[model samples]
Each structure stands twice: as C-alpha cells, then as structure tokens.
Target: MDRLERVLKGKLEDSPGASCYWWMGNWRGRGDLADLVLKSRRVLEESGFREGMRLGILMPNCPMVLALSIACWSLGGAVAPMNARSGAEALLRTISILDLHGVAYVEDRPEIGEALSRAGMPSAPCGLEGPLRPFTGRGASELDDPDTAVVFSTSGTTGLPKAVPISHGNILNNVTSSIEHVEFLRPGEVMLNALPNFHTLGYSVSGILPLVGDIAQAILPSFVPADSALSAINAAKVTGIVAVPTMLSMLMGAVLRGGERPEGVSFIISGGDKLNVDMDRRCQELLGAPILEGYGLTECSPVVSINPSYDSRRLGTVGTMIRGYEHQIRDLEGNLLDDASEGVLWLKGPSITRGYFRDPVNTAARFKDGWFDTGDVVRIQDGYITVLDRATDIIIVGGFNVYPQEVEMALMEHPAVSQAVAVGESNSMTGQVVKAFVVLKEGQEASPRPDNRLRQGEAGAFQGAPKGGHPKGAAPVQHRQGEPQSA
Candidate 1:
C-alpha cells in the first residue's frame, strides 16, 4: 500500500465512528459509502490482480471506479490514470507506449472503445474483482516506482504529450499537504468532482484522495444544465467546490434563476484555466463567496499554487504557492523577476514530475537544473499570482480542464468536420468557453444552425485522413478584431 492508502486505512481503522459519502446520481443526499470500498478491496483480491507492474484506469467517477481505485493501489500497482475524454487517436498513442498486458474501461463510452480499438488494445470490461491476499512483506513496490504503475504523460494537447512518471512518494507529498491546506477531510467539507478522473485534478481529488481523507466527492459524468449545479450546491451543502470560472458562472446563473446556495459553501477554489475577474465578482454576490483561483500543470501533480481557503481569495489571481512550493516568475534572460513582474512561470519542488518517458531531449529542454518552466506567463502581486493567457491555446471550463488540441481532435473525428480550431472566448459565467472555428470539406459551407445540422458528417469531419494533410484539429489561430479564427 502507498503512503496515503496506508494512512487512510489506519485513520479509518482507528476512528470507526468517522463516516464517508458519495453521490449515486438519482440517489440524492450524502450517505455512507465506506462499506463499498471495503467490499471492493475483498472483491478485487478475488478478481485475480493482487500484484502487477502497473494497472491503468480510464473511467468516469462511478462508485465502482472509486472503489476499484482504492482496492488496486492498496495491494500494489501505481494506478496509472488516463482521461476518458481523450480522442481515439490520442488514447491509442498512449496504449502503444505502455507495454501493459491489460486495461480496464469503467463505462461503456463508445469513444473509449473506439480509441482502444484504434490503438489495437483489447481492453476487457473493468470488473471489481481484483484479487488480493494479506501480504506480510513491507511495501513491495518502491515508494516511487521508476518502473511501477504511474501516469504516462502530462496533458497531451500541448506539444508532443510526454509521459510524466509519478511515484508513491510524490503522491504523498502532493495530496497529504493538500488535505492539510484545504481541510478537505475534516467534518463539514464537501466537493463536487466535476473534473474528470483522467486529469491531475481529477486523479488526485476524485480518484485517490477522497476516501483516504474522509471527504465527499459529488461525481457526475460531466457538469451541465447550469441550474442543476446550483441545486447541487444548496442541497449537497458543498463546502469547498473546486471548479473553473465556467462552472461557477453556471452555478451563479442557477442562483439568479432561484437556485439557492446555502451558507454551507465556505470556499470555491477555481483553477485549471485563467480566472476571470468579472465572473468572480458575480459569484461573490450571488453565491455569497469570492472565487479563489490556483495555477498548476499536470507535471506538478496539478497543485503548484492555490489560493488560501480562508484568508486570501484574490479574484484575478491564482493565489500563491501551496504550503511548500516555490512559485517564480522569470524574464526571458532566465533571471527570476520580483513580485508584480509578469514573465514565464517556473516551479520546482518534490511535486515536480520525474521526467517524460522515452523523450530525453524535450525533458532536458523543459527542466532547468531542478525548476520546470511553466510555459504560461504570470504576474504576482501581494502574494497573489495572476495568470495571463497560456503560452498556448489550452482553455479550461468549469474547473474540468480542456485543451484546444483535444477539442479540435474531437471535432475532426466527426465525419463532417473538415477543419477545426477551438479557442477560448469571453463568457460572463465560464470565464472562457471553448469556441470552435471550423472549415468544411470541399462542398460544405458555414451554417448558422449548429444543432440543426448533422453532427457526424456536416462541416468539419473527414475520415481516415493523415495528420496535417487536412486542416483538421490544427493548432491555435490568433484572431484580430472582426476576423473569425480558423485552423
């Protein structure tokens, strides 16, 4: 068992009175779900998977997913997580790298299946029957697995997606400190897992740390129908809801539409994209709290810096570094700039990813001695860091992270999408919502009716075209006034 799993098991064992909870879609209100975890542990052992090099999970935040994650890591295996929302080609690209003998798909999403099939990975339906026996031997897996179960890459949308290896030691440093800072496990704390399990935010909060820390995560396939979000806040009595500006806007809309936000919600930590100031103020007025933003990349275990839950709720800034990190702003000369000076963000700490798998050239380029250059430019003022536009076109929605490349890839996968480029556009609610600029195949023309058109074979999609040969899923196109951006 890893440090956190051991700590949680010990903690839960020590305090039998302590309770945990989760959401079961139609089943409303938080209730005890710890028994399911215990059963999963026993069932996983019975399912013939006690020890392994590593086990990969690409699932939504289902109850079984939560249970199976705890069960697998408890025995051994690093619990490598991949995003279920990734494009088929992107998913296949990863499978080709991991020499894994097996894979588990939690939901029946055709996208996951299509991607796996395209990748030639014959994944079986994920079963909750991973077998386990009491192993007397101490920590069979190294605290950090150089070759054990681990995350394969950072968010793949930017550059060539590089595999980032994380060890048990790394996991402990990040989450243990996180719970301490956020007080997530303490009584009266509730979180909404609107973020997917594949990304770092999802992996840490939804997949791993919840039960281990004795907190509740309201899991949904995806956050939508803005009004329902507000109802969730009031009904769930959510304390610390981690979302991006988009989700906050949705919730705010819900509140204005008679959606009640109970006083129980104490903190709202917004990150995974640039924080919008206007949206923050609206939320503060409606939801009765300020929006706190943070900044981090997947390579940093996704928590490089976050706003302090109680004291510092800077509206435009992504707060300061977390308890132990050194967040820096550097000029082009590679010299660290003093506070308030805008420059590229550089971070270094125990949380830094080991390196990219099989790509040493880029790895050396990205790392400077110990600090990793965060391509995003940021300015720090009064200990609050304000993140500007990305060094690239990655945009985050409602705290569930998104990248233009990923969205573009999806649009291109549609049969009619001849070319697509997703960009961040202004919205009072979501800070930034993904806007796609599409070019059609030879016969297609841009249409006003987006929903009325055929989703599969209308404007952007073309089949079996080699990469770059067609304009599909191209990189970001900067826009000037009165011009529509294109791939």
Candidate 2:
C-alpha cells in the first residue's frame, strides 16, 4: 500500500470514533471519514478514474474536498488541485498544460463549466451538501503507491505557473519530519485553517497534517472579511492557525477596526510570503500568540523550513531546518560556500520533489544531481537560514547589487509607512536603481526621503538617489493597489 493509504486505513482502524474534522459547524468522526473515502473512491473508480489518472479538483475549503483528495490518492490516482481564485483563462491554461482527465469542483461555477466545455472535458460533483453513496473497497494489501499523489500550482510571480507533482513519499516524509519538530499539537487542539487547499500550505500543512496527527481542523471558506475567520476560531475554540503574511495583516487590520480577537488561539503559523517583522510583533499582540514566520515553495512539497511553535525561535530566520532535510550555501557558480556566507540556497531531502511535472527544461535548470536550486539568496548561520531575497528581485546599481527586500525594510522603518514594496527602476547610467512604494498609516503624511539612520546607515546609501534633480527620462514612480507613490 502507498504511505497515504496506510495512514487512511490506520485512521479508520485506530480512531474510528474520534472526531477527525470539524467543518460547517459540525464534527465528523474517523469512521464517518473512512466510509466517505470508500464511497468517494468507488464514485471516482466507477467514473473511470483509476490508478495513474489525473483528476483536477476545483473546489473551496471544506470537509468533502479533503475526503475527495484522499479518495483519489487511495485509489492510486493523482489529484491536481486548482486554485478557485485564479482567473478562468489561467485555470484553463493549467488544465491544458496538465492534460487532466476529469475535474470535480464544489457547486457549479459557470466559468468552470464553460472552460471545461471549451476544453471538451467532463466533470463530477463533489461536495458535502448531499448524501454520500455507500460502497465497499479492498484491503490495504491491494493498493500500491502512485508516482505522484498531488499536484500544486506555482504562485507564478515571475512568469507562467508550472505543475508541481508531489509524490506520496515526498509529502509523507515531510509531514513526519514536521510533526517531530512541532510536537506540541495536543490532542483535541483545534486549528483554524483559512488557507486554500490548492496551495501547499493549505494542502500539506492544514489538510494532510491534521489527518496524520491528533488534531481537528475548522475550515474557512475564504480568508476575507477577517471577522468571519475570527468567528470560526471562536466557534471551534481553535488553538492554532495557518495563515499567510497578508492574511494575518488583514485579520489584524480587522482587529484594529474594532473586531474582537478570538480566544484560545495558541499560535499563528505564517508563510506564503515574507512576514514583516513589525507586523509580526503586532500580530502577536493582537492574537495573543507568537507569530512563527516560515519559508517554503510548491516544489519542496510546500515546506522546507519553519519555526517551531513551542521552542526558542529566532525572530528573523525561518527556524532550523526540519529533521531529515540537509541544506547548503552555494555561490552563483554552484561552488559550495561556508557557513554564514550569503549565497544561493540548495536543498536535498526526501521531502524535496523529484522535479517539476513534465517540464524538462525547467527540471534540468532547477535540479542538479540531487540538490534543488531554490533560486533564493540566503545567509546561513549555525543551523538557521535567513532568506535575503529572490535572485531575480535583485537590482544592479553601477557595480553594486541592491536587494529589494532591504529597500522595503528600510522604508518600513518609518512610523508613517504601513506597507512597502520595492522594485527596480531602470537607469541609463547605472543599469538599475531602487524605487519604493509605501502605504501610509492613518493620518500620516508622506516623507520624500527616509531617515538617514534607518536607510543610509543600515542598508548603505540608496544608489542613484535623486541628486540635484531626478534622473532625466526616468519613469514616474508607480504605486501598487492605489497606494500613494513616492521616490
């Protein structure tokens, strides 16, 4: 049997009467989950989805989505989860790229139906609103692990998203290693899962981790209207939460806007993007728990490193590498660098994926020998790693290199600035220069220049700063999301 199938069967045999999932104001026991998986597996098999077939799941966060994912894998098929928030064109492009056999989405999204019709594909209904069919299945001895258990969509910040296929061994090993590191999830501790299932953080951490461990999860339809998320936590008396940096920021914004912070929240696990240090402190103040910042990518089964919730965690680093994972620092030429040296981060572990699905060019470029080039510039000290920036986000100023993160951090030092994103603006004389955009705090005025102590002393001087006048023919500084622009 595959590792996932064994886990499912164990949940059925060992904890049949224990609650496995808490969603939509109800609790589902393991026996109920096991029966649902069996019926769901039969439904998929009868619909012609069998071993090695690809089934796309386009659904919101709910109990059935989790069960269906397990059912597809239990039958030795691969599940490709689609992000519901992605545009139809992008979703269609992904569908074409992956060559999905069939799709199952929650309820009827006309856009999904239209896209499927255009692609000439069929889909099935997989939701919890209706009664589940009854079916019988074989023993664990009959099932073997498929090559890939789940496929996730890349964030595609730089370009087109690639399909990342994670094997059963990849995710199972990662989950085991994570459990060893964060061994504080007491039984019956409820986790508020607001992240989407399509992403790795949502699937592996929130969805699968709970199944393997003794925790119950409360699902949120989406991470908007922050009050709703808080309400879910209160209703479940949740002690843990998984959220991205932006989601936490929004929730804190709602809290500051007179929303009450729910009780029993023990810690907030933050990932998906870099967590600002200032916001991290504020989140702790609001949520009454420590904000454990983390770093990961879809290729690494979503998590390569994370801070331990119950340990002494370094504020600025993504904790020590989880057990069984080995990492190294390397220069641009791939030569190994010593500890504490800043360079590219290369990781090798059982949890790391084999490569991107069916993309040979990218696979060759990303994986060398057994090590995967994470494409991130980082500084490793002792066993802790600090991510500096994406190699692509660096800007060249004359002969020197400036990281956008450093510029953004410098801008965020000001009390007036609430958020910041730095981008490279092209310069004829000096290859590229840094331009920063920042959101202002309420009733705060914009400052044309940051304090010298904050920017010049720590990050060095901003190269190509406007001297007598702005660079001739320089593009006007652009603000993002309608925020005020300043250079």
Q: Pick the candidate with the highest lDDT.
A: 2
* Candidate 1 least-lDDT 10 residues: 131-140
Candidate 1 per-residue C-alpha lDDT over 332-443 given as tens digits, one digit per residue, 9 for 90 to 100:
6678787568898888887777676556776776788888887788777777777775665566554555566766666665554566667776654454566666666666
Model 2 Cα displacement at 304 (Å)?
A: 1.5
RMSD of 1: 6.8
Best by TM-score: 2
lDDT of 2 by residue, 1-487 (tens): 2478777688766878887777787877888878777777778777766777777887777777777877888777778888654445456667766667677766555555555666676766556532223222222222323768998765333345577889988888887787777755556778877787887888888888878777887877777778877777778888888887657766787888888797888787877655566766787789878787777777888777778764777888887788777888898888999867899999998888888877777788789999999888998776777888766554544323344554555456556567777677766434466676667677865445444423331221112233444332222333344464442
The TM-score between candidate 1 and the true structure equals 0.76
Q: Cα lDDT of all candidates, in order?
A: 0.59, 0.70
Stretches of candidate 2 exceeding 4 Å from the true structure: 128-145, 155-160, 393-487
Model 2: weakest 10-residue lDDT segment is: 455-464
